[model samples]
Target: MAEKKANPALMKPLTPSPELAAVVGSDPLPRPEVVSKVWDYIKKHDLQNPQNKREIIADEKLQPVFGKDRVTMFEMNKHLSRHLHS
Candidate 1:
């Protein structure tokens, strides 16, 4: 039997555009890099609401992607997909 590898399409690095840069930063990054940068921003800015640790407060740049003032961490990955391409 042969083992199957993860889809390369899923693993391919996505180049972030200017719209993404405004949210994540000016750094030119791939999808995984963007995710890490976003997390770093969340941590550094202390954007997670205290009452609900899962809820993140959207900043000026993050607002466009989030489509609201707040979002749950669980929903973050799904939201990210909108900005990424295959």
Candidate 2:
């Protein structure tokens, strides 16, 4: 059997917008890494709603990226897409 390689596009480093940079830093990073860093920040700040783990409560720095006080975990990627560029 042959092995499949990871998609190059997903591995490519991307720049984050100013709003996202506040949470994940300004360094160019792969999409997965960016997501991971954002999760780390969320955990560090205890931003996830205890009553509803699927919902994330936005902090001051996250307000711009989230565009609301709260959002579902599934919607986070949708919002994040707007702030990333190659």
Candidate 3:
């Protein structure tokens, strides 16, 4: 059998739950899409702390996923995995 490689697109997309939708919107999207949207929101909102670029300020919708008021960008990916399934 040939070796299998992970397809970036095959990853399941995460849909915003009701609570999340209140902040992000009602759109159901893939994990990558969600992440991109979150990043866009962060950038547009200037949520990143100037002293720490790695840190991301969690808005109301993202607070549940992050489990904290703030998270490092690296931690964002880690936390996002919990909200997704294979």
* Candidate with the greatest lDDT versus the true structure: 2
| lDDT score for residue 65 of model 1 | 79
| Candidate 1, backbone clash total | 0
lDDT string, candidate 1, 1-86, tens digits: 89998676666777555556676765444676788888998899899999999999998878887788999999987887787654
Lowest lDDT sum, 10 consecutive residues, model 1, at 23-32
lDDT of candidate 2 over 1-85, digit per residue (tens): 8899878998899999999999999999999899999899999999999999999999999899999999999999999989999
Error of 3 at 32 (Å): 1.1
lDDT of 3 by residue, 1-86 (tens): 99997676755555666555555576667776777877888898888999998888887767887889999998888776666543
The TM-scores of all predictions, comma-separated, are 0.76, 0.94, 0.70
Using TM-score, give the best candidate's number: 2
**After aligning candidate 1 to the native by TM-score, how far in Å is the CA of 5 from where it should be?**
8.0
Decide which is better by lDDT, 2 or 3: 2
Q: Which is better, 1 or 2, measured by lDDT? A: 2
CA lDDT of each candidate?
A: 0.78, 0.94, 0.75
Superposed model 3: Cα runs more than 4 Å off: 1-11
Which ten contiguous residues of candidate 3 have the minimum total lDDT? 15-24
- Measured with C-alpha atoms, the lDDT of residue 4 in candidate 2 is 92
